[model samples]
Target chain A: MTSTLKTFMEEQLPIIESHMYEFVEDLTAPTSLKEAMLYSLKAGGKRVRPLFVIAVMEYLNNPTKAGYTVGAAVEMIHTYSLIHDDLPSMDNDDFRRGKPTNHKVFGEAAAILAGDALNTLPFGILARLEDVSAEQKVELIRLLSETAGAEGMVGGQVLDIEGEKRQLTLDELVRVHENKTGAILRFSIEAGAILAGATQEQRNLFVEYAYHIGLAFQIKDDILDIEGTTEELGKTAGKDVASEKSTYPALLTLDGAKEKLAEHATKAHACLEKIPSNSKYLADLTDYIINRNK
Target chain B: MTSTLKTFMEEQLPIIESHMYEFVEDLTAPTSLKEAMLYSLKAGGKRVRPLFVIAVMEYLNNPTKAGYTVGAAVEMIHTYSLIHDDLPSMDNDDFRRGKPTNHKVFGEAAAILAGDALNTLPFGILARLEDVSAEQKVELIRLLSETAGAEGMVGGQVLDIEGEKRQLTLDELVRVHENKTGAILRFSIEAGAILAGATQEQRNLFVEYAYHIGLAFQIKDDILDIEGTTEELGKTAGKDVASEKSTYPALLTLDGAKEKLAEHATKAHACLEKIPSNSKYLADLTDYIINRNK
Candidate 1:
C-alpha cells in the first residue's frame, strides 16, 4: 500500500513539476537570476501544493491548463516562503528536500533576492495563462493574493514566530495552523472549483473538505515530529518541542492529538461525501493526507 | 517659475496620498505587516511613478477610480524594490527621503517580509478595482509583472549591482538604467493609458513619450549626482562615483551628459506633440523632468 501510494503520487507529481518549470521559466528574468531560481526550483520538493492545485482541478474536471498558471504560482509562493523561512533569522534550517536550502547556497541576500524573484514570478505566470475568462483570471489573482498575504500564510508565520516560548490555546493554535498550512490548501481546491465552473455550493463543500484536511495535515505533522525519524521526515524532528513552540501534541496529550487527527480526517471525508461521487481525486487526496507516512 | 512647479507638484501629491491610504485600509490584511507597510508607504516619497500613471489617466479623461488600483500597485512594487535595495547586503543606505529605510527600522528579516507583503498587496488592490473589464485587468497585471520582474527592474538591478566596481560601456549603462528605471516609467504611463482606454495610437505615442522621459529621467539623475548638493537632493550625492558604478555622467563628460539630457528632453516633447495641444499636464511633466533641481 505504501509503495502504491508513492507510485501513484510519483505519476501525478511530474505533471505539476513540468508546469512549474514552464511557468517559472516564463516568469523569471535576467539569465543569472533565472538560472539561480530554476536551480533551486528543480532541486525538488514533493510538489505537494502544486499537486494539490492540479488534483483539485482534476477532481473538478476543469481543463488542466487553467491550473498551470495557478499551479506554478502557488508553488513559487510556497518555495519563496520556504527560502525565506529557512533563512538564518527564522527556522535557520540548512537542509530542505534533501538539499541545501536557498540561503545555504545563495547567501542570505541573494537568497532573499531569489525568494523575491520567485514570489513575483507567480503573478507573471498567472498573467500568461490563456483562454480563461477575464472574470476567472481576476478571481484567480485575488484568491492567490489573499492566501499568500498577511491574512493567510505570512500571518501564520508571524504568530508562529511570536508564539514561540509561550502557550497557545487550541483555538489560537488552529488559527495559526489554518492560515499557515490551510490557506494555500483551500486556495488550491477553490481554484479547481472555480475553473471547473463548480457551483458555489460545490466550491463551499470543497472548502469544507480542505479546511478539515488542512487541520488533519498539520496534526499529522505534529505527530510526525514526535514519532518519525529525521531521515524519514527529511527535516529535523522534535524541534518544536525543543524550541517550546506550540503544536497539537504540545497542547494536548499524544492520544488527544491522535484523536484530533482522526476527528479532522473523519470531517474531511464527510465533506467529500457531499460532493459528487465521481470525484475520485478528492476522495483519494483526503485519504492520502490522513494515511501518508511522509 | 520654481514656485509654479512646486505648487503644481504639491497640489497633486495629497490626492494621490489619500487615495493610496484609503485603498490600503480597505484591501490589506489587518495585521502588523499592513501597519509596517503603511509606515513606509505614507512615510513619503515623490509619488512620481503613480503621478505618471494618473497623469496619463487624467489626460485621457478616465475615471480617477480606475487609476487608483494600478496607481497604488505600481507604488507598492516600487516601494518593495526600495526596501530590498536598502538592505545591508545591497545598497546599505540608512536614509531614504530623509528617514530610516525600512530595513533599518524593522530589521533585515522583517523588512524583507514587509517588502514581500507590500509586493503582493498591490495585486490584491488591483484585483479589487471595480468597473474594469476582465481583459483590461489581466493586461494590467501582466504589464506590471513584466515591468517589475527580472526581465525589467530586477534584471536592471542585477546589472547595476554586478556592474559596480567594473567598467561598462555606454550601451551597457543605458541597458541597465532602462531596465532599472525606464521600464517602470514606461509601465506608469502605459498603465494609465491602458486604464483610461487610450487607443493604440494614443498609447503608442505615450509609450514613446515615456521611453524618452524615462531615459531623460535617469540622465537627469546622473547629472544631479554631480551637480546637486546632498541637502538639495535629499540623499547622499556622488554615491555612484564613490561606488565606481557607471552612470551617464560616468561614461560621458559632464557636458556630454547635459547635452544628452537636453536631446532626450526634446524627444520627449516631440512624443507629447502627437497628443492634443491641450494636454498640458503631459507636457508639463516632460518639462518637469528636464528642469527639476532635485
Candidate 2:
C-alpha cells in the first residue's frame, strides 16, 4: 500500500474523474445543462476528496466499487457547492479553477439548475449502488447527507454569508470553517473508513486526521489568498481582502496564519501516525494541502 | 377510510406541518437561517403532497412512520423547489401564496441556501429511518432523487425557463409540466405504494394516475391564470400570457382547454378505479385539483 504517492494518484485520478463524468451524462438531457455540470467537474480539480476515499481504502488493503462510487459522489457534492457558491447571489466570483464560473458560461438559470443537479446526483448514485449491503449503503448515505445538509455545509454557508457582512470572532470563524470545509472532508474520510470496515478506533483516528487537515486546508487557502498570484491560485487572489471578508490571514497576520497552518498539518500527520495502515498517502496529501500554490 | 375529506384533512394537516417544522429546527445555530427556512414551510397552503402520502397510506391501510417521514421529506423537496424557482435567476417572482418569496424575506443568498438545505434534508431523513429495511429506504431515496433531479423536476425547470422566452409546442409543454409538476406528485403517490408494498402493477397504475392528474393540474393552473384575478391566485395573474408562455388554453381554444382538462381527469379516475386501495380521497383530491379557483 505504501507506494510513490504521485504514482498512486496518477493511477487513481483519471478513473475517479471518468466515473464522475459517467454518472452525470444522460442520453436525452438538455445539452447546456449537462455541459455546465461537466465543465465544472472536469476543470482539472485535484480530486482530493475522491482520492481520499481511494487512498484510505488502499491504506487499509481493502478496496471495493463502493470506494470509487462514494469517492465520485463526495466529489460531486464538493463541486456542486463550489458552483452554487460562485453564483451571483453568493460570492459573485467570475472564475473558478482559472476558468469562467458555471454561471458565466451557462447563464444564471442553467447554472443554478446545474448546481442543483450536481448537488442532487450523489445521493441517487449512492442509492443505486447495489454491490454493497443495504445497511452499509444507508450508513454511508446517512452520514453523507447529514454532514452535507443544513446543520453542516449549508449551515456554514449561512454563517459565511453573514461573515461577509460583518467581522466574526475567532470562535465564530472556527465554527464556520469546521462546518463548511470540515464536514465534507470528514465525510470523505469517514465514508472510506465505513467501506473499509474500520473499527471505531481506526475511524476515530481518521476523524482526527481529517479534522486537522480540514482546518489546515482552509488556513492554507486563506494564506494563498494573501500570498499566491492569480495564475498560481487559478481563482482571483486577494479575493478575501477585496471583498473585505475575514480569513485566517485577515484576523492573524500572514506569518501567524502560516504558523497556524503548520500546527494543524503537524497534528494531522501525528494522527495519521497512530492509524495501523499505510496512510502515508494521506500524510503526503496533508502536506500537499499546505504547500499547494493554488 | 371514506370519512369526509375535509374532516380528514383538518385532522392531518396540522400534524404534517408540525413534522415539517420539527425537521428544520436546530438549536445553537443562526436564528435567521432557521427562521427563513420555517417562514416558507409554515406559510399557509394546502399541504397537498404530504397529504397525498398520508392518504395513500390510509387507503392501503398500511400506516407506518415511513408515511409521515416520507411525506415530510417530499414536502421539503417541494418547498425547496418553490424557493429556488422564485429566485431572481429563475422566475423572479415577487410573491407566492400571498406572501413575499423566500428571497424577498431572507435575502438572495440565504434563500438559495435554504432551498439547498431543504432539497438535501430529505435524503438524510430517508437514510436515517429505522422502521423500514435499508433496501426499502434506498429504493425510496433513489426514486425521490431521480424524480427530483436533473432528468426530472430540475430538467423540467430548465425547459420551463426556456418556455418563458419562446412559444412551446403542445408536446414540449407536456414534457415540461410532467417533469416539473408531474414527477413529484408521481413520487408522492408511488412512495406510499412502495411503503404499502404494492405490486409493480399497482405502482404503474399510480404512475398513470399521477400523469393524468399532473397534466390536469397544470391545465387548470393555466386556466386560472387566464380567468382568476390576482387576489384569488395569490400571485400575479395572467402571468403566462404576459410572459408569452404557452399553455393548454393558448395551444387549444379556452373551451378546448377545458375539454382537455376534463379528459385527463376522467383518465385519472379510471386509473384510480383499478387500484384496490380505498382511494376515495385520491379521487376527491383529483377533483379538487381541477376545480380550485387558485
Candidate 3:
C-alpha cells in the first residue's frame, strides 16, 4: 500500500469502526438480535466501501463528521448484504473473513432477522443525518435504495444466481458485476461526493473512477480465489472454480483477467486525474484494489 | 363491516392495489425477481395496513394521491415482513393466504431477495413522494426504519421466536405484540396523520387509537387461529396451538381474550371520538378488526 493510503487507513479505520459499533450499540433491539447484527459488523472485512466514502470527502477537502455517519450507514448495508449472502439458501458459506458467518453463530432465524434489521437501520441513519440538508438526505436515501434494492444489488444477485446455471457471455457477466458488486461501490463514492457537495462534473468523474475500481475489485477476488491461500484471504479459496461459478478468470484466462484488472486500474487513475482534487489517497486506493492479497 | 367501511374499501382497495402493483411493475429489476415480489403482493391479504393509512387520511378529511403512495410503501413493508416471517428458517410455513409462501414458490434465495428488495423499495417510494416536503420524507423514512426495524418488528420477532420455546408472561406477550405487530400498524396510522396535516393533539389521539386497535388486531388473529377454519383463514389454522406458541388465548383464555379485545375496541373507539373529524370509516374499521372471522 502507498504511504498516503496507509496513513489514511491508519487514521480513519478506528473512526469508521467506532461509528458503526456505536450506531448498532444504540439500537433499542433485543440483545440477541443486536448481537447477531454486531457479529457480522464486527467480523473484519476490508472496510473498502467506507474508505471510498471518506476518501472522496477528504479528496474534496470538505471532510465532515457526517461523512463518517454516512460511511457507517454504507458499511451497515454492506455488512447486512454479507450476512444474507452467506445464508444457507444463498452462498451457503459457513465462514467469512476467517470467522463463522452470522447464520453460523446466531442460527438462521436470528441471522435473517439480523440482516433485515441491518438493512432497515441504514436508511433511518441516513434520514436522521444532522448537518445535512433534508433534500440531500432524501437524495441519499433514494440513491441508496435504487442502488442497493432489487434493481441494483439484490437484482444483480438474482442474475448472478441464474447465471451460475448457464455460461454467461462477457456482456452478461459485466452486467452482473456492475449491478451486484458495482452498484453499492458506486454508491459509496457517490455518497461522499454528495456529502462533500462536489460539482456535478466532479461527481460524474468520481462515478467513472468508482465503476472501473468496482470491476477491478471483483476481478481481484476471482484472481485471489485461485492464487491466494485460504489463510491469507481469510475465507475459503478455490471454491469458485469448484462451484463452476462464472467468474472473470473462468471466462477470461488468468493472464487476461489480470490484464483486464490493470486496464481498469489505468482507466480509474485517468478518471481521477480529471477531477481537480488532492485525490492521492484515491489514486493509491485504486492501486490497493488491484494488488490486495485478500 | 359497516356500510361506511364497505364503501370505502370498494372505492379505495383497487386504488391501493394498483398503486402497489404499479410500483413493483415499474421497478427496473430482473423479470423473475419482479415476479417473485409481485406474487406475494398479489396474494390475497386484508390490506389492513394500507387501509389504516388511507382511513386516517379520510378521517382527517384531507385526502390526497400521496396518501395512496405512502399507503403503498407501508403495504410493501408489511408484505416483505410476512414473506420473511414465513421463511423455512423462521416459521417454515408452506402456505399463506391459501397459496404457497414466497420461498415455496421462488426458492429460498429468491424469496429472501424478494423480501430484502421489498424491505428496501419503500423508503425510496417515500423519499420520492410528490407533494411531500423533503423534511416530511426524511421523517417518514426515519419513522419507518425505527418502527419496522431492529427496535420494533424485528426485535419483536426475536421475542416471539424465543417465547415459542417456553411460556411467556402476559406482559412479555404484550411486549411481543406491541413491537412485532403493533409497531408497523402504528406507523400506518401515524403516516396517514402526518400526510393529512393533522394537529399534534389529533395525531397523538390517532396513535392511541392505533395502539388499541393494534393489539386488538393481534388478539383477533389469535382468536381466529383457534376458531376460524383453514378454509376461512386461508392459512394453516391451529398451528399456534400445535406448536405450543404463546398467544393471547393461551394467556388470557378465549373468553378473557375476547373481553380484552372488547376493551381495546372500546378504547380505540373513544380515541376516534376525541378526534373531531369524520372518522366513521376508522371507527368501522376498528369494529371490523374485533369482529372479523378471518
Candidate 4:
C-alpha cells in the first residue's frame, strides 16, 4: 500500500517539476546572472513543496490551470529559502538534496543574487495569473506573501536560529516550527482552495487541516531522523542530534512524541472530514503524511 | 532652482517613508517579527525607488488606490535589497545612511531572515490593494515582479559580482548596469505609469525616459563616489574605488564620464518633451537626476 502511494507521488513529481521548470525558464533573466538562479532551481529538491501544492489543489478538484501559477510561485519561494539557508554564513552546508548547494555552484555572491531573484519571481508569477478571477489571484498572492515573508516563515527562521544556543520550552518550539515550516505548508493547502474559489468556511477548514498536518509533518521527521536508514532518508540521519537544536524527540519521550503524532493526525483527519465526501485526493494526502517513512 | 526640486523631493521622502512604515505595520504577525521587518524599512535611505514609483503615478494622476499599495510594495523590495547588500557575506558593510546596518542590530541569521521577509512583503501588500479592480492589481503586481526578480535586478547583481573579479567589456558592463541598477529604477518609474494606467505609447516614452535617467543616475553616483564627501553621502567615501569594483570612472576619463552624463541627461530631457507641457513633474525629474549632488 505504501509503495502504491510512493509510486503515485512519483508520477505527480514530474508533472509538478515540468510546470515549475517551465515557469522558471519563462522568467529567467536575459543575463549571465541567471545562471545561478537556474542552477539552484534546477539543483533539485524532492519537489515536495510543489507536490503538496498540486496534491491539495487536485484534492479540491480545482483545475490545475487555476492553481498552477501560484503553485509554481510557492515552490519558487521554497527553493529560494533553501538556497539562502545553505549559504556559508547561514547553515554553512555544502550539500542539499544530495547535490552541491546553490552557493557552492554559483559562488556565494551569485548564489545570494540567485536566491534573491527566486524570492521576487514568485510574485511575478502570481501577478501573471489570468485564468483565475482577479480578486482570487490577488488574495492568493497576499496569502503566499504573508506565508513566506517575515511575519511567517522568515520570522520563524529567525526565532529558530536564536533558539539554537538556548533551550526552548515546548510552546516556544511549536511557535518556531509553526512559522518557519508551518506557515508555507498552511499556505500550500489554503492557496489551492482560494484559487479554486472555495468558500470562506471551506478555506478555514483547509487551514485547520494543514495546521495539524504541518506540525505532525515536522515531528515525524524527527522520528525518521532517529529510526530511518541513511538510504531511506537521503542526506544524513541524526544530524539534528549533532546540531543540538530542539526537536520533538528532544522535548518529549518517544512514546509522548508518538502520542502527539497520533493526536495531530487525528485532528488533521477531522479537518478532512469537514470537506466534501468526494475529496478522495485529500484523504490520500492525509494518510500519506501520517504514514510517510522517509 | 535646484533647491526647490530638492525641497520637493525631500518633502516627498517623509510621505513615502510614512506610507511604507504604515503598510509594513499592516502585515499581521508576531510583534517582534514585525519590529524586525520595520527596523530596516524605517532606517532611512534616499527613498529614490519609491519616489520613482510615486512620481510616475503622479504623472498619470490616477485616482486608483492601488497606486499607494504598489508604492509601498516597491519600497519594501528596495529595502530588502539594501538589507541583503549590507550583509557580511556580500558588501561586508557596517553602516548605511550613517547608522548600523540591519545585520549589526540583528545577528546574521536574523538579518538574512529579515531581508527575506521584507522582500516577500511587497507581494502581500500588493494583494491587499483595497480600491483597485482585481485585474488592475494583478497587472501591477506582475509588472513589478519581473523588474525586481532574478531576470532583472538579481541577474544584474550576479553580473556585477562577477564583473568585480574580471574585466567586462563596455557593452557587457552596460548590459549589467541596465539589469542590476537600471531595471529596478526603470521599474520604479514604469510601475508608476502602470498603476496610473498609462497607455502603451505613454509607457514607452517613460521607458525611454527611465533608461537614460537610470544610467545617468548610476553615472552620477560613480562621480559622487569619487568627488562627494562621506558626511554628505551618508556612506563611506571612495569605497567603490577601495573595492576596485568597476565604475564609470574606471572605464572613462573624468571628462569622458561627464560628457556621457550630459548625453544621457539630454536624452532623458528629450523623452520628457513627449509628455504634455502641463506635466511639470516628468520634466523636473529628468532635470533632477542629472543635476543633483549628494
Top candidate, metric DockQ: 3
Residue A207 alpha-carbon offset, candidate 1, angstroms: 1.3
lDDT of each: 0.79, 0.86, 0.93, 0.78
The collision pairs in model 3 are none
TM-score of model 4 (CA atoms): 0.94
> Which 10 consecutive positions of candidate 3 chain B have the poorest summed lDDT?
B275-284
Q: List, residue by residue over A29-146, the lDDT tens digit for candidate 2.
A: 6676788889999887788889889878877879887788999899989988999999988989898888899999989888888989888889989988857888988888888888
- Give a tens-digit lDDT track for model 4, residues A171-263: 999998899889989888888777666788988998998899989988888888888876777668888888877888889966788889999
Model 2 residue B6 CA deviation in Å: 0.5
**What TM-score between 0 and 1 does chain B of candidate 4 receive?**
0.93
RMSD in angstroms between candidate 1 and the native structure over all alpha carbons: 2.0
User: For every model shown, what is its TM-score relative to the native structure?
Assistant: 0.95, 0.97, 0.99, 0.94
Write the residue-wise lDDT of candidate 4 on B72-100 in tens digits: 77878878888888887678889988889
DockQ for all models:
0.61, 0.69, 0.93, 0.71
Model 1 alpha-carbon drift over 4 Å, by segment: A1-8, A26-28, B1-8, B27-30
- Candidate 2 Cα RMSD (Å): 1.9
Rank all candidate structures by their DockQ, best first, as comma-separated numbers. Answer: 3, 4, 2, 1
Q: Distance from true position, residue B165, model 1, in Å?
A: 4.3
Query: Cα deviation in Å at residue A124, candidate 1?
Result: 2.6
Which is the better candidate, 1 or 3, if ranked by lDDT? 3
